[model samples]
Target: MLRNFVILFPAFVSLFWALLFMMRWKRNSRSQNIWAVALLLLSNSMSIAALYWHDYEDYSLIYKLDVLETISTLSFIPVVFLYFERLTGVKKKGQIFRKILLFIPPVLMGGSTVLFYLIVGEERAAEFFKYIVEHDGALSPGFYEYRYVYMCINVYTYSAFLVVQAVLVFIYAGRNILMYRKQLDDFFSNLEGKSMDHHRATLKGLMLFLILVIAIAGSGNLLYVDFGFMVLVFLFLLGGVIFYLCYHVYFISYSADNFIMELKLSDEEALENGYGIMGEDDFGNADTGNMLRAKLLPQLTQVIEEDKVYLQNDLRLDDLARLLHTNRTYISRFIKEEFQCNFSEFINRKRIEYAQELFRESPEMTQEQIAEMSGFTHASSFSRVFKQCAGMTFREFQKGH
Candidate 1:
């Protein structure tokens, strides 16, 4: 009964998330597609193993499927990293090189199974299975005879690959996050890495998800515990991913547009710009920077007023630049020099100004309605920015009115 559950639990979780992924996949969401594929790999491998568990008569078939299992697992490690890479907007300059390094592990890990198939053959697979569950594990007396070969496939293969992959994933994810934090700093003097920003919040989720993946993947194969008990742990890992998938689905379905709206790019614009508008380092001045503030500042104000661009929740300098038909650095300087504030404050001030208008014009709008109409992504974000700009909470401001 317990054994049946170990298999059923993960298989069920996998199937559920697979449905969610498929739904999100229909929406053409790249993020969902990545995870959908990963879940499918985990599900298929475990399902195969479970179906054949009692059929030791076809033991070679099981071992071969385990080899396939290892490959399925190998498929997961890099794509998980790639998911973060794609999410965090890592620059593409060195990606080719990074991909090469990323793929080396799966390739190196594959060599283990090939060598296993060669020396041990299907006949020796049963013995290999015994070695895993008993003995000192790889230290069995016969292991020394063909020691170097056996150790290469067992000790030096996926075991080593996993360790290196964990270190690399941690360094890259952390580094990308720190750089993005710096970007938030440069863009808005008031904005902090407070996880209120959807990107930062999602980064936290990504870190959690990756940690769970590493912990489970590393330990699952080790089976250092009883194999039966280890299966439960793997089920727990699947549960963790399902939780992350729920989070991922929320963002993609509900907030992804809010986040993308911050870029103010159409899909075409994103492709054309290569999403390059926001990350420019030289916010100093472009050739067009020579325009007199007296002449250009009013145009900036006009665009914001006429277009009502201030109401976008995740609006960025790049969006403002695109609106003004100028470069982001120029817009960055415009907000600082003309408004004497960062982008967030400049935008929030306008939103508060607009919210104040709605208060009088409609005289019946809820704070939430006002917040939404004014371009806030959430009530909390709206209230926080409103309070910062108004010198009072929304209630206090309402009372004052």
Candidate 2:
């Protein structure tokens, strides 16, 4: 049974990691994608190491496999930290220092591999079996002395690193949960009459589940015997369960439904208050109900007036959502339903409008500067959008209009 477990565990871990990898691939590009791919590759390599251990007893082969596993294991720490930073929207300029810290573990593993090769020598390294069966069929072992020490170092180092990484993630998750809770409180505070207990409940529940998953996965690593692989599997299963539960809860929960319903409440308040703008039939409506715009038009107009949203490079849906005190879904839906466009189009329209104004008023500002100031992270995207929206290239617009 033990032998079977030894052979099967790595494969199971690999399969779970592969599923996570595929999930990240389908999402938009972000730093989390980097962490997901790194972990997926590390798990795959660990799977190969386990297979090699089951199939080969050659000391040299074992040494090489250990080297590969050590390298992958060591990388888990920094990648995890990077994932946390990206997910939290925290950017530190001196991040290269963190990258340097990540290099330490791999370098140590590589050094140990070289040291083992020198001490064991080629002939003995090739044939030395690391384990032997006792006369009574009980366990006995024989391994290269220095290599065993190296292995211990590798394991202990990775375990310590894992603990540290897990703690960091836990702390970050806790902070985020608190912030989200506060935001929910503020949002609900303004509501009149009936309580927003249901919406608050669902949102808080989802956030709590997410925090619990991270906590379980992190603490499980410390408690479990096999680097928490089994715990990780359970975590994955739990996460999937929670995800489906939240999906149902979100759509069916009266609070969330009420929130959506609020979009339609008080048509006069929606239209006359500048919170909602009526679009013509040209904007393609599947239903008979007229699409309304955000009631916070003055606020949005102020954002446009200040030109802050478009001026910042690396603008994202979440950023805009944060600024608007709304969720990404609402912002995305508003852009789609009211503007008859997507986020990129909505952003580009604002940018192009600003660029046109700049071109006319400030002939001194270069097109490149205009593009940068217009909230484009890249000149290419700005140029493409400008041409599409203005019916002319930036230079042409500047020169002709």
Candidate 3:
């Protein structure tokens, strides 16, 4: 029963998540499709672990399952990279080819496995397997003509590929997230829901998963000796990580695309304009800069400070630009130059200042009341930003006052 469960648990978890993603595809096909396919492959690959429990004499079935597992392992990092790309809203031109390139390792590795089995023939393949099993995995290079090729493709090459892919994905995904957060700061004043915190958590989970995978793969001998107990542990970890990511991705209502669409801009245009409205032709003009400095800067200050537009909970850069009858690019630039902060920081500073004023006027006001009145959608956000702007927590500041 334990052995059966050891084989079945990961497969069941993978299948369950795959089905969930499939069901959700209609509502969110772009994100769900890749995840569904990945989990499906994972479900199929779990059968490879069954070999440790019972010596199945079926060489062809074993080879096929091994190939599937190899393909799944090879594709894991790339799938993670794509998932992060989706979450971070890092849409770029010609991504199709780049994504295809990332999967090339899996394709090549799978093909090589198939070719190895065909070339070795069932008799020799079975013989090789029996020898490896009997000898405690001591390789006899002289016994198999293509032993080195098999080892390279199955072990060293794939391990090296996984490490390289993990490093690259880590670097690039992190960079994309940082860039996304910066973009959000420039585009919206209230980043309560748009902060991509979920994505960051998923990324951290993915890194831990990769490290576990690499460690287990490196210590492959333990799986055979421990009767695949480590595989069960690995799968349990995998299920936990998958559950975290799947649950978050499933319920996450934030769509970077929808937010960009709300701004009424295309991805390419948004990228070029830095999520603002000014075209290349209007940038870096001494006259335009001077005019914005003299007129637009004061107007921005007046609208935000005097008119108290920062009290609007959903205030955004585009809304301010529309009100000022100017492009967001100009306003964004002016905010940076005049206040030395991005739009989010400038507006949140104003909101924090307003919160301070309220705190003084009505010291009995609750945190939630002050947050709502000061244009923060959440008390938690208001408190966090208050501490950031005021260098103390609300309670501490109130006590001082």
Candidate 4:
């Protein structure tokens, strides 16, 4: 265990730091929480491996470690599903089936353990450990046969799950990219100046890096036939590189300082005007209604003032964050806290509001004209949001107003 501890210490440390970083985001993000839990489980698996390395001579102990490994491996599936759900904005209908799938590996392994105990009994279990210790790293033929079957089952199940997850990830990523590209094309076609160029470059880089990372991870897994732990090490290193890119290149290069400064100014203005003030302490502090209002007002103002930007054909949180010179996490938090809406709803609300104003002021304009002028790519979306928000059909609004 000590020898393997030294070999595995770096991985454990990397995972710990990753978990810490994730915990910060997890407060406001379901996806981050899922990933954090998955990493923690993987860390547990590593610790179990260390224990097994020390007690490899004990067959019973080895079997118990194997059971732990199976459980840890299965835990990854739900995390993957949750990650995809967040990435694609898809909601699970019940999630009961998914939960069952996640539990299957552990249940099977536990059942096997019970069966082993029944066959060998408690005394034999102890005797078996002593016999293996005396035999010097050699196991009985029956044990080898059982272990081989177990390993095969694990490999097949894990590989099948990975394949399913990979397919889902690719599909989700593709849809997001397509939507993002369409929005960029629409916005860039209208806007000019360095800001637009900066946005374009940033989006391109972010999307490219995401695709590259996924490709690398998939390829690394496939090459496990030869690489084994080397591939896993490469993945760990790649994750570190991604963290560096996100912090230094993406966040810093975007100049989030401007956004933070703006937020500070807004806070001061709100306080001086007796509007509201929101404070987040380093320790656990309760959130107040005034503070919530204060934090949300600026974001709402931005949406109203920058309606054109928000009405992009393929708008997303990342694109909005770049435009605001902030991070996606901040944007997501603002939408949830202030508007009680998701990113899509926040953007749609802006579009609908713009359409409402057009319909009110430009009474002579047709529904199609108003929708187009209000930044809606289609009149259908305009009508849908208009009815939902205003509680009246577009024709009714036009007629009544």
Candidate 5:
């Protein structure tokens, strides 16, 4: 009973996640959804291989199932890379190449597994399969010594592939997430409805979780112990990890979809408004990035100075980019290339300058009131930045006044 549960528990979980992903795909129908669905197929293949390897042990069919277990034991990398792809704005034309690259390892592994079985004769393979299963792969050497060595070597080699792939995905995905944070002065502003700090922490947590998965999966193979016990431990960990991934995927999709929709609306508005955001001037001269900044600065300065956009509690690069009829990348570049600072610093400096103006106009206005009018969401945060930028606390400034 325990042995069957060990195999079926993860199989059921895999099936559950597959169905959930299918439901998600029905609604979203994205490129990532296809790979996510493919990852689940590999999950099912891995689970079935375990069931046959242990329960239907000592059979020729069990050996074949074990070979095909190469369907991708470490399948999380593709799923994660796809998730980050949309977030980082990978173009659709290039995704076909990325999808093919991600599948190369699994395809090679599966093809080799089939080739290995075909090269061995029926009778000799049967003997080999029964012996390995009966011994639980704790075999020494016999006439089939080379075959045993081959199988052991294959497992370790595949584990190495999984480890390296996970690390690479984490590195690439981690850098993009960081870039997104820095480019948007309003970190949470571009996240649709979610909190900025929460989502950034979530991205970091996901990368760490992938590392944890590598450690757990790698440990099981390294520890030569009872096959059944190892399967039990592995499935338990798999269940927990799968649940974590599904929960996060849900929220990421929810937020990203909203973000895309909002951007679409802004695009339509920009087109209708007839703003020359693409560096075109009235004289019809094409403006360079620097020239574009010069052309754009007057309109942007007027918007902030007269309209008081910085006074809004929530200001996003997306909102500014849309109004200017440009893009987030351009806006971020405008700040760094033109102003010598990142978006966050640039926006905060504006808010601080506005706050100082407020202080001068209304001596009786509380710092809390000033913060509310200066685009800060919290009085505590406003006070902290006020001191940092002005070189004195609110109390000190107030006392001088």
Candidate 6:
């Protein structure tokens, strides 16, 4: 019973998270749904571990379940990549075809497992399973030849697949995450809940988890290590990491779907309201929009400077554009051209100046207090930006003041 519980713990944890993710399905986001499915498949995949840990007398039954086990294990790989793909907006055209291609490896693995079973036959398969369990894979040249060849092929192929999968997923996910940050900086002023920092942390955790998995698998296959207690420890750690990932995913404040939807609405409204965010290409003459920029620049400066719109902690380009009766692209371009920064940087620069003013007025103020007063939603952000803008740490700036 202890062995059974130990092997099943991660599966149970995954199922629990799948249900939790389902509870939020009313939010109707593709990423959430994909994550729930990934967890569900992960639960199914955990069942294979039980075959190793439990004292199963029915070798035939174990052979019969091998195909399902193989499918479950390999299927989670692509579903997980799909989840991150959607979360980070790396989705492209031909999505259905792409998904089908992603699923090919799992299908091939399951098919190969079935073919191997048919070739070995039920009697030999049971004997093979019995031998491995009874002897801990210590087979003589007589019995070992078949097992050794097959196990080597299986382990090496699976290990190679895992390595390639990890490389592709990490590269694409890391690149997309960096792009996500740039997107946030382009559109948002105060990026408290808008950042992908949580996702980046999760990616790091996944890297460690993958390393553990590779170590365990390679050690088990090649080194003939005792797996009973090791498997239990691994399951425990896997359960903990899954719990951390699920908890953070469930409570994540940022939603890419909502962000994109809001941006679409802003664009549609801008087009309908005669502030179409026209570019130089839209105008016949290169300098045609200079008069409009000349007229709007002062109003933009007045709102940011005199009216102190930058003090609003959740300020955005759309909000500023609405206040100035302009389009987002126009405001974005104006800030870039006139102030030599994006909207986010433009707002943060003013906020930092305000923070400096506060420090001079009240040198005893805390970082958190200054952050809140100067429109930064977090002190950590304030501290980082303070160093970037002031060329010194907050403490150094405060001491000088």
Question: Per-residue CA lDDT of candidate 1, range 1-401, in tens?
Answer: 76677656665777677777787576745655776776787676557645443334555566666667767766665776676565555555888798789887667667667666667666676556555445324444655665566556655566667667766876786777676555553344234223435445555655665565566445533432345565566666666655665454435432232334554544357448654343333434454344445566787878788878776666667666666665665567667776787677777789889998899898689988998898876677778888888888988878878
What lDDT does candidate 2 reach at residue 48? 51
lDDT for residue 162 in candidate 5, whole number 0-100:
73
Give candidate 2's root-mean-square deviation (CA, Å). Answer: 20.1
Q: lDDT of candidate 1?
A: 0.63
Better of 1 and 6 by lDDT: 6
- lDDT by residue for model 5 (1-401), tens: 67676666655666776777777676653634744664576575657555544546446766576556665554556666776766555344666776677767677666766666667655556666666555655443653645654554456656766777778778767776665555344333322344344456546666655676587458633322355576577766766665565555555543344556666776677667754256323224444655776777887787767787766667766667766667665666666666797666666778899888789998889888988888887887788778877899888988987
Positional deviation of 50 in candidate 3, in angstroms? 3.9
Per-candidate Cα lDDT values, in order, are 0.63, 0.52, 0.74, 0.52, 0.63, 0.75
Ten residues in sequence with the least summed lDDT for candidate 3: 220-229
- Which is superior by lDDT, 4 or 5? 5
User: Which is superior by lDDT, 4 or 6?
Assistant: 6
Clashing pairs in 3: none
- TM-score for each model: 0.68, 0.41, 0.88, 0.41, 0.72, 0.88
Q: Is candidate 2 or candidate 6 better by lDDT?
A: 6
Q: Please write out the lDDT profile of model 6 over residues 1-401, one tens digit for every residue.
A: 77678678888888998998888798746877888998888787676656655667898887677677667767776887787777767556776775787687678767777787778788887777666666665643455556655664456666666566666666666776777767777788877876366777767766765666567556645322246677678878888888777766666567677678879998888778866656545333546677777788789879978999999998888888888877777777777878898888888889999999988898888999999999988889999888888889898987776
User: What are the per-residue Cα lDDT tens digits for candidate 3 across 1-401?
Assistant: 77677566767777888898887687873656776776777677665655644666675566567777788878877887777677667777877877887899899988988898788887777666656655656565656678787778877877777777777778777788788888888988898776366767766766776676677567654334434565567767776776776666666567566666766663344455554455534647877667656777678778877899999988888778777766777777778877899999999999999888998999999999999999999998998899999999998988999
Q: For candidate 2, lDDT tens digit of each residue in 228-346? A: 35645643554454444233322332232243344345343434445333334423454433322435455566775674675665555545655665455455666666678766566
Stretches of candidate 6 off by over 4 Å are 1-4, 92-101, 138-149, 195-197, 220-225, 277-280, 283-285, 289-296, 337-340
The collision pairs in model 6 are: none
Clash totals, every prediction: 1, 3, 0, 1, 0, 0
Error of 3 at 287 (Å): 1.8
> Which candidate do you rate higher for lDDT, 3 or 4?
3
Model 6 TM-score relative to the real fold: 0.88
